[model samples]
Target: MILPYPFPLDIQSILNNKNIFRRPPTRFGKMHHTITHPFHTPDQLPMTNQRINHEPVFLLASAPWRESSLWVEVFSRRYGRVALLARSARKRQSELRGVLVPFVPVSASWYGSQELKTLHRAEWIGGWPQPQGRALFSGLYINELMLKLTTREDPIPELYDALEAVMRAVCGENSHTAALRRFEWTLLNRLGFAPDLFHDGNDEAIRAEETYWLTPENAVVPIEEAERFNPRNHGVAVGGNILIQLREGDFTHPESLGQSLKITRLLIDNLLPEGIKSRQVLQQLQQFSFGV
Candidate 1:
């Protein structure tokens, strides 16, 4: 009969039977005691208890947990956002030290039925370059967006692909702003918060000469109609031409870039009641650079 929870098994017994080298104790002592049962081979454990192995993932964030462990958040191609407990990851010689880094792609394995899974293995898949400078900050902003907007275990493969593409674009010279705008738009669209750029709330096609305001309800209002709309529900004013440009995924125009940034930021802020920490950091960094 299947247990409601994962049955704890001895790591030593499983590893020994598989001839895998035993891990030494961590600095805190007795690290082996915290190591969970191994499922290196599918046949070693019952089919119901088999570990999910080598799933493609991108490390979003990590924090120190117990003495020699880490609490990690990863964006898996197959599993979306996942919370993983990486045992002994903080140890000096642990292989995970270099592997668990943001931006770079890696394959991760885990096993558990609980909300938090136990990380079994991770290996670097190494194709994309690690973003640096402003690009690095941009990458962090995207990570924060993912963490804030996505729920765990909800697979969004399209969003994952967009993230990878945006990261690459951000790393390229002169593409940071455009890449970020596109990514923000893509993310909002995928999450069902995208505003109707081509049409107004009345289902009227947007005219290039007309100005409109993007509403929190993901609708656009003509400026004249917006004046009559509830004052408390007002949105950021955007040019109809810019909205059409954004809908076409073109942010090459200076005005288009600025308007897109303001509009997307407003939408994202509306969704994230607690606000995005990384965005604040990014703004501070921008201010400091201007001051310098």
Candidate 2:
């Protein structure tokens, strides 16, 4: 199978789905070709706009609907991710045209007793700067992840919190690397796939002075105690101090950010086997920035 060019590492683990270490879904090739925009409504009505007056939401995506409206995807605290059909949202005078944008928090008012909600009104609840440049790419990547992993109207309270934190971090344009990595780890942990960041292969607490290797099996092994695993599987090497910083979401140390990328890249590749559109866009931006 031809691999996606987003990363050049040995991504055989993604194809085989055997590593089980820091694993993500291995069907992104499927996510790419088939489920380009996977939109769905809640299976049950109780999960819809039952008691919530105006739910805080982030517009994950939007597609043309009926030539004058939009089929929007939104991520909310109790509603997980859901689809809303906004009538006349594309009209020149529509309030939603300016309100339903990704990265901006909105208070959405929608009503329906069925699976899909008909969005009536959306008000800006913004108090943060919008993500721009590289931050925009990061936001797109994150929105794609949410579109892929989250179910309609399912409560993702923790992931919702992480999303808020990421938006603020990226717009802040400081420590974005660590912020992105932390979001990736949080997603994996919520899915019960990520390993413990504070402990190692022997279940011992990671120390600041030690050097460790992150194995493909998601094991954090002390440099001196890494012989049990296959040498080839002993992946990126990182300092225990950096791991500690990563654990605490501290990006003060530049090395910690680089190390975080190496680790998260491996884990994400493990998750999506086919390819990610946002990754391609990001690579293009990087190449353009360097005039390559």
Candidate 3:
């Protein structure tokens, strides 16, 4: 993935910098325990004129803002994507330093009426072990998607759940291509950009025996109709069976997996005009690393 604009902060550099975060504790520590909070729908969260405390969050991206402060982006279950200013976070003993790492679930508190809020507190919650090696890049790729595709303050709880599920799956032993595909599909569906795999442009129910083209405009059309409309850019030719499999979230077949990947890539590229940087890094690693 190639982003239109370079990220202000380099994730690789941050990961390499040993002084950025403190070492993890051996067992349950003051800041490493689970947070208990009353369950509420995202809409129930205070939108204005109040401070939100200990909201469940997953750090998406961060960058240095001003002297001793960090600009943080997080995906909150209650508030969606939020921008925060962590003051004095660069200080060696600042509480926010260790708590702000990516991929871990954290309970964060912030106060402000403006677009960017002020971080008051952050606490790490237990989660699956951090993704390593290729899984790490894949996790970063997922973060880039969240950062690019989601709008700040627009809450989508389902997407948040999907993120956690995909991250856990990606960190496991096997390559999680199916998990990634499912996540991409879920994200697009939540954002209302998912193509109707079960129906064609005319809204007719797709037949399992028919072949169709997934058009650039995100419509499914019968191969014959697509050829008549425009043969040059009728989209990628996919089998009806594969489309059905994708619609049902079943990627058991290699053909379905391949077609799903193509379709998801097209949809994500359509949304992210600048492309994704982490994806480019992943491709590079795969190309150079022997049997990565």
Q: Where is the poorest 10-residue window by lDDT in model 1?
A: 1-10
- Local accuracy of candidate 2 as per-residue lDDT tens digits, 122-215: 8888658777677777888888777766656667699899999888888886647777888987776665545566788788999999999875
Off by over 4 Å in 2: 1-37, 40-51, 113-115, 223-234, 288-290
Model 3 misplaced stretches (Cα beyond 4 Å): 1-47, 229-234, 290-292
Off by over 4 Å in 1: 1-50, 286-292
Report the error of model 2 at residue 87, Å.
2.2
lDDT of 3 by residue, 1-292 (tens): 1011134326434434444222222121112211111111223335575699989898887766557777777899878888787888877778776678777788999998666678999888878777887788878888887776676787889989999889879876487999999899887777666677767878899888988878645467788776565555536778888888887889888888898999889867855555678877667667888665
- Name the lDDT of candidate 3: 0.72
Estimate, for each residue in 1-292, the C-alpha lDDT of model 1 and write its tens digit: 1011111212223324554323222222212111222223323323233478999887766655657787677888777777778998877788877788777678899998666778989898876666767677777788767765665666789989988878777665555888899999988776666776767888899888988878765368788777776789748887889989988899889999999998888877766655666667677778998995
Backbone clashes in model 2: 3
Per-candidate TM-scores read 0.77, 0.75, 0.80
Residue 228 C-alpha lDDT in model 2: 68
